[model samples]
Target: MSFDLTKAETPKADDAETETAPEESAARRGGLVDFLSGPAGRNLGLVLALVLLIIVGILTGGERFASTDNALTILRLGSVIGVVSVGMTFVIAGEGIDLSVGAIVALCSVWATTIATQTMAADYHWSVMVFVALAVGAGCGLVNGVLIAYGRIAPFIATLAMLAAARGLAEIIAKRRTQIIRERGFVDFFGGSVAGVPVLVIMFAAVAAAGWVLLNRTTFGRRTLAIGGNPEAARLAGIRVQRHTMYLYILLGLACGIAAVMLMARTTTGTSTHGTLYELDAIAAVVIGGTLLSGGRATLVGTVLGVLIFTTLTNVFTLNNLDTSTQAVAKGAIIVAAVLLQQRVARTGST
Candidate 1:
């Protein structure tokens, strides 16, 4: 009986170990899954890509590419586009596109830097120019939202029309000339910085941080994701898909306005050519940052990294004496690679 009891207890212990092993294994798997889906995991590839680019810069451009001044220059140049990219993130996340972002930037800048706006700024305050730029940006966004969300026009068609009209309007207003900003206060304030960082860079950081929070921690963001994932389903779920879509466009407009102000400060002039090809750049950055072009997923961190990558890439190319055509070719290749990688990731996730 004693020998039989010992054998029975051995079997029970073995069964217990078998049960615990699976639980432990499952716990480990769950943790891995969570980490991969989290922010750090989401951005790991971009981080590695950035690091590799930096290494290339160091190797090819040596000290010139590694200098702190050059680094700041990259950030400074990327800031305006980075801000615009933040807005583009929201729009694209909601399964909408705004091919008119560049045009809108040009229009806002021209409007804000016009002689009339300058005179008003001189009489009242520099804030006048800021307000005007914001108003114009929001207004254009409103029109786009209305056309797409309510009029039921496709995003591509609406934004394309806007791209043409806004650019034309900007050309008309500026008479195809650059409008110089005369508000010393405006320039000094926006161009100025705290603790040796450029104000433009600070603005970019602030906007990016805010965008991340808004997109991740708010009901509006949830609704945007829901709508992007499935518009009909989101509408059926009482998400007010149309209204939310309108708001997303308007949010993008506000970002364009902010970017306009930053651009004016950086260049001290507003021209119809302020954001040439910026829409393509923003779209590329957003796509490369891991946001789905088909919607339903987004990543602010990825977008920031994407912006830095392009900025750094340009800096590297410049330091190495590369030409614009070469840079364009490089960018095209990177975009293609990123899309392919994203597709593979999507397929793997689905499986």
Candidate 2:
């Protein structure tokens, strides 16, 4: 056993190195795969939420949930809300909020209603009406953008002021009364169904698809996420953060205006109190769908599922004779739960 100590130790050390090299390489590969395939593959909460929503829809609405007719109905109802949420999504993705969407929508619809409701015109040109309504909405958004971007105001405060002002303007325009209006025959097509499919549904699809591409595929989307993640870092990277923020707010305003057209068409009337509490619902949907309010990361499909879950729940509650107060309580509880889940996920991620 008294062999040459140096010669004996050299081979032993070499053997140990040979063994660890392969083992370490294998472990590294395995870790990478798991990271890519597990939680890193996609937003698990969002995917799970979609599955649960489909199950609930099937359970409550039965075949009606999966059926084309019911699916079409969901799209139709979800579209207008979805459109506003699209802009909301961008705003939230960029670490901001717009509280004035509902009021802006009410204003836009009432503006269009005045023109369409006129008896003497005898013809409500749908295209012209839509343009005017949307322009008004864009104008509101421009004001909001300037206030928040250049005026150096918090988004919540600026939009909240706009919310009160816009609602007041809407009420004044409607003479504080619900205005009943009839559009020309063809002008009503936006609210009408084609081949049993609602036009609003088609519009929603177009907008959502376009939005998805913008957020996922464009440089603008990447820059939005980057700024949300770290504005200072983004600014260092040569991105004009303020300009982008302004664009996003304006875009949100336009979306709200579009939503107004849908709502007005569906009801054919303008009311001062219309779209009340819709911002809450929209925010709830976005959050419940697993979109992070912290900004940078968002899920468009998840928002869709969130909207469906909320509306389905609302519809079911109504059908079951639930009181409005109870509904409010239920919605609030659900929102809290969703935020809690997101918080847990973040904690786990950090750990």
> Candidates' lDDT values, in order?
0.93, 0.79
Cα error of candidate 2 at position 59, Å = 4.5
Model 2, span 131-239: residue lDDT tens = 7678988999999999988888999999999999999999999898887666555246787777777888888777888888898899988988887788889999999
Enumerate residue pairs that collide in model 2: none
Best-performing candidate as measured by lDDT:
1
Tens-digit lDDT track for model 1 on 21-131?
999998887677666655677699789989999999999988988898888999999999999999999999999999999999999999999889899999999999999
Model 2 residue 71 CA deviation (Å) reads 4.2
Give me the runs in candidate 2 sitting further than 4 Å from their true place: 1-44, 50-71, 116-124
TM-score, per-candidate, Cα-based: 0.91, 0.84
Residue 92, candidate 1: Cα error in Å is: 0.8
Cα-based RMSD of the predictions, in order?
3.2, 4.1
Q: How many pairs collide in each candidate, listed in order?
A: 0, 0
